[model samples]
Target: MSGLNAPISCDLLVRADAVVTQDAERRVLDDAAVAVRDGVVVEVGGRSGMEARYDPGQRLDLSGKMLLPGLVNAHTHLPMTLLRGFADDLPLMEWLEKHIWPVEFQLTEELLAVGARLGCAELIRTGCTAFLNGYLREYVTGQVVADCGLRAVLGEGFFSFPSPMFPSAEDCWKTVRDLDARFADNPRLRTAITPHAAFTVSPDHLAASFELAVELGVPWQIHLAESPSETAMCLEKYGKRPVELLHDSDLLGGRTTLHHCVDVTPDEIAILAETGTNVVHNPASNFKLCSGVAPVQAMLDAGVTVGLGTDGASSNNQLNMFRDMGLAALAGKVRADDASAMNAQAVLDMATLGSAKCLGWPELGRIEAGFPADIIALDLGSPNLMPVFNHVSHAVYAATGMEVCMTMVAGQVLYLYGNFRTMDIQSLKTEAGEAAKWVLAAAGK
Candidate 1:
């Protein structure tokens, strides 16, 4: 973490009239102000008490709004925003084969960086402070995220054949390590092992990814049991289900986070819990791709740590946490047929704390004295926020990304009142458009 600011003074204090601290007590302090020091929250209480106790360097007024911890998108593909509306109305395999894969093959360094910057713009505007992004390559995506002031756990998509970045298996191995070393001392970015999936990554490649993850002390993200076709193929080729194969291969462990456990059995859920592995539920992606509903409630009931994610805008159509929470909550209750299947408060926690845990970040999620001052203010004056009976309930059911008035990460404000503070979106958009033209032509579109 050499490039990280050396944990300096917080140098900022923010006062929001309505502070929604999603702590164990679920305290919502009125006329509250938060004190932040060295990028961490030092105190949260009444404005008078805080002003009297500490002299503030910078004070921000967030009256008529609700302050909560910045959201955590447990999984995403940041650069995939360029392909969002580029491909639609197809199943997972069909979409990938017909549209996504072709464009991915034509993705140049410029295209990758522009797409990532555009995605970063979208995330900052929508109040997402951090995300776990699995990338096809590393150099450009890492640089874009670091330059744009966002945090992502990135990795090379361990593919079996050729890739836009890595042309061969040897190239893949070299790229992962090189990217890991490049970002090893980085503050805002860390590299993880992102094997495409069991369907694409052979056993040898997956084992190598696990070894690399352990070597770098990073976590792993991979698609597991996403479709019945995947499990059936694994059974045909490897004589076992996808989860069973991973378990027998010694890759099913705490350091692994699997995506879309749709075809997994109850026993597989037990294995995830027993091994401390996590699962990411992308309800919108599943529904759009017709991948079937994941037994997420079953996984949670089995003590597995579950987090919410918008797989990618291409699959999800949007990257908004409010909508993600809505879909996540509805997905559970619809499958379980229980009104109390996933509480609104629990879904909010999933977007905040639970997703943080899945990414191995401890200080995020909580609005406590020692947590990072990554916070957001949602303006509750919109028609949706009107007559709010419960703040948390309104946040889950009524709110949308448009209500976010500010987004702060590491005690630094990146977006405020619909305006991004750190980057130039117009220039980024123009550059991305130029690269996308090349992409579309190269992709034979």
Candidate 2:
């Protein structure tokens, strides 16, 4: 027995049927338990072994559930949750320029906060404990996420031209600086410098933004080669593709997280792998917008770190990572014309460890010793998850987000058995409804 002489003290102990540790070996321990102390995972092993090792202040028994690392949403516009289904059946450019931008013009900080709270609740209920969000009003969104007891890499969206949020490029920079300062010491939140996209952000502004990102030591995020037209526009205007433009601007590196990348070529894929740049593939959003399927299989084959993402609620219409995992696997097989392409395990990893890499959060993904106690439990007793021949396969192919019964971040239980512990879900829904109505009316939609 561990601590045979003196008993060890821990904050919490979680016992489950199986602990799916996505570690180097990807071990799934039956009758496993995890010991957490001060928000860190102290031990993960057999239940009996952990029980012998430590005496925990609180105990949670999930006997029929499987414990896994909390799902990580690599990319999203969380405030767009209020705009879900606002505009649909439109192309990317048309959707943004014609429908989305007009509605965003009427957005307020309060609306953003309301939407963020709803998004956080949805994410927690669905087992997502962390996300990388790129959107406007990030100051409000970041605070709301922190208050909701989740982890996030919140990025303030910037554009070369004036928008409702920022009257000028300088104003945008000021907000970025302020956000960086505010979240410098925050444990649950980090700031990123997010340029809207290559086509929308001027070259000068892009360069400056990247410089600022490097200075702040934060990840640089941008939508690159999301569509054929965007790539063509870059080639015509700058005599380079979006990837090449980033490379020339000194923005292609380990700290860059490029969203979509549906229109990239083989050469660009090589560049991405060479630079160790991360990619977030939003299969559902691409399909909804009629954007081409991303070259995920090829990118993976080339050794590029690609993660799955739900782009935004307005485009994806949902914040569920389970749906994204299923779609990613199905889309990769269809795109590659091979049954072996993008296996279930790979898709699950994308939603967890791979997505954590995109956010530069090395300690947030895996359920291992020394890692954060950010984890979720799935109801293996659910009908769809019955006959659990393979937990990982079921997680990616059959299970939906609704199967998530409990979600915990850093030893803090944020959701349990359809109940939220941090935020009031009913109040958030009411606020989101009012905000949506106000925005739609202001936009004359």
lDDT per residue for candidate 1 within 14-79, as digits (tens), equals 887678898879888888888888778988899877766666678888877889888888888888
lDDT for each residue of candidate 2 in 324-433, tens digit (9 for 90 to 100): 99999999999989999999888988898889989988677789999999999999989999998889998899988899999999899999998899998778768877
- Which candidate comes out best when scored by TM-score? 2
TM-score of 2: 0.98
Point to the candidate with the largest lDDT. 2
Please list the C-alpha lDDT of all candidates, in the order they appear: 0.82, 0.90
